[model samples]
Target: MVTGLTLLHTSPAHVPVFDALRDREHPGAVLRHLVYPELLERARAHGPESVAEDLRGLLGDAGGPVLVTCSTLGAVAEALAPALGAPVLRVDRPMAAEAVRTGPRIAVLATVESTLAPTAELLAEEADGRPVSVRTRLVEGAWELFVAGGTARHLAAVAEAVDAVTDADVIVLAQASMAGAAPLARTRVPVLSSPGPGLAAALRLCGADTTAAPPA
Candidate 1:
């Protein structure tokens, strides 16, 4: 039986994305995916705090080292870690930390408006007193395309937004869904995505050996 990491996501699209990542990074590893689309709807309709009760209930059955793939709920997941009695990780954290270490000027690109604040806040926390500047850009209409199952168009829009940010030392893709846009972005600045780094962290947290995984 293959047992490794458990992922909590607000969208079903993430299932394939992370599944593919695991196949490439940790071949033959098994992953459990728990997607709750309503969680995101409720969070966006209300606020991050409003999802706390629902999240707590949902996470009650989740296994350790659960990776929350929604950027808007990243902070809440981290906050609930202690109470959850399991390792709850936000997908963007590892990417945010890496962005902080990469350069002083960081450009964060997101499709969802709610993702902007959480991502920027996480980046600042990762900076840890370092003199780093973060600029956030929301790709207009990209989320609608993604919701309508237009993956290619959504990626192209995000890539265009990435290319528009000319003053950044590094570009950070705020949402895991935005990872696909990284390679499509035609820019000199390094584009950092969450899945690779987030999966690595999830494996570590779950006590899975990552020696065979490719270098980041």
Candidate 2:
């Protein structure tokens, strides 16, 4: 039985979101976090393998379920999963699965440039040989705003970007932090976020029931 979770995240700002969900889903289940912005930065600066070695070490040490919370590093998580010797879940995998079901015209929106490629790749992989048209958009200056703690401003920028992508059948928010900002978009099509489904999946992967009542 799974009794703990080890969350791997690129940004510290995302911890609260996952923490709340973990607490709600399974209160007091051992939760450990590995936050390293430099990991993703290294991926961008050098290559995905740049962080694979470090991730392997982390996963080897994680005694419970591990969740990769960064879209940019999700590929590395998948690659190292075979050697992880434990259950590993990607935060965006569920989102990718659902997004591909919507339509072929998928638009992935992100604030960080690094998130785009991996997200689109995940969607394509989820499509499972089906022809899917995936385009990516980076919200101008949204990452800066988010890093500066201007979350509202950052969300507004993301919402605007969503509004601008009218041709897309569905919009996939590439980063977990942007999950909350999706609803702010005035769009006719579905706007998808990873955090909700991802957290649900994580709980399940770790042998916790989504409907299981939390401790009062």
Candidate 3:
């Protein structure tokens, strides 16, 4: 029995993206959620090592590949890489590279403040002093909409936020929670969702080519 693992922050905004990917691969695979409001509250309260331990515990003895998704949890995945002993996908890196390649002006929208640092660092490194212009903004109340069962509202807010960043050539939605908002995030620029890249990476890690058509 092959199993695939993926982690989501306590937010349900990621449901659509995860559900879509899961239906494509393992229809009934288990999904683990790690909630740490305290850890997420403070900017420097914890690091990846602490988050990784929580992940290992939540994913106890699950024998399969794991794909972790979180804008603020990338460092956590990095810390857990040694322990999980399986392929871990950090959703932002690929998106960052894609953003850099798209053009000079890149706009990143995220709900959490923690995501800003790593995202900026990743983009800077990927840009490699190409004089790329990077701008970031926090979607002030979008996450609350997700928690309050207002997914559509959240998507609308995200679209509005993206629209506000019209100067960008490409927009990167940093949080997986923001994935559902991708389709609604109408922009003259390209909107890159974490799930697309994350799912692609997960398929590659599992050695599965998801490029095939879905069942009729």
Candidate 4:
């Protein structure tokens, strides 16, 4: 039986983000975060397939549902899910489904260029025969700020990107790291972030009680 949620992340920065989410929403939920910065670097230097073995190595022992939070590696993880023993999920999928339900026109914003294609494809898949149009925006240079530990500036750039897309019915933050920008964005349309929805999905997949009361 599944005992907790296992989060696979390419950056260590995501640890606190999802940890805080579990604390606030799931309180007692067990969450194990495996962060490997080199995984992303190798994927960027080579290709997504390059990390397939590495991910398979890490996931061989992961308990409960495994959530892959990096958009660049999401597809690879998903492709390996059936053989990985545990339930593996891409973090942005829930958000993508929500975006498709919200409207036909969707805007996918990503700080890194690599994230756009994967996220846009996820949205298209989620459309499930519905007519959906997706627009992608790459917040150029914002990823540099994020890597430099300037989260506030990264979020500012993302928020600006969000405001620039005025024609979309809903804006999707392709990276879980970009979620902070959602609240700061002053856009007319709804902004969707992955972390919350992703965690909820992971909990459900693991058979955890998502509606459980939070710690006081």
Full-model lDDT for every candidate: 0.88, 0.85, 0.70, 0.89
lDDT of 1: 0.88
**lDDT digits (tens) for residues 19-117 of candidate 3:** 777667656544554445544544336654556566666544545555656667675665565666766667677788888999989888987677877
Q: TM-score: which is higher, 1 or 2?
A: 1
Clashing pairs in 4: none
Q: Give me the candidate number with maximum lDDT.
A: 4
Which runs in model 1 stand beyond 4 Å of their true positions? 211-216
What candidate 2 gets wrong by more than 4 Å, as runs, is: 24-30, 212-216
TM-score of 2: 0.92
For every candidate structure, what is the RMSD over all alpha carbons to the true structure, in angstroms? 2.2, 2.1, 3.3, 1.6
TM-score of each: 0.95, 0.92, 0.79, 0.95
* Clash totals in order: 0, 0, 0, 0
> Candidate 3 at residue 126, lDDT?
80
Residue 90, candidate 3: Cα error in Å is 1.3
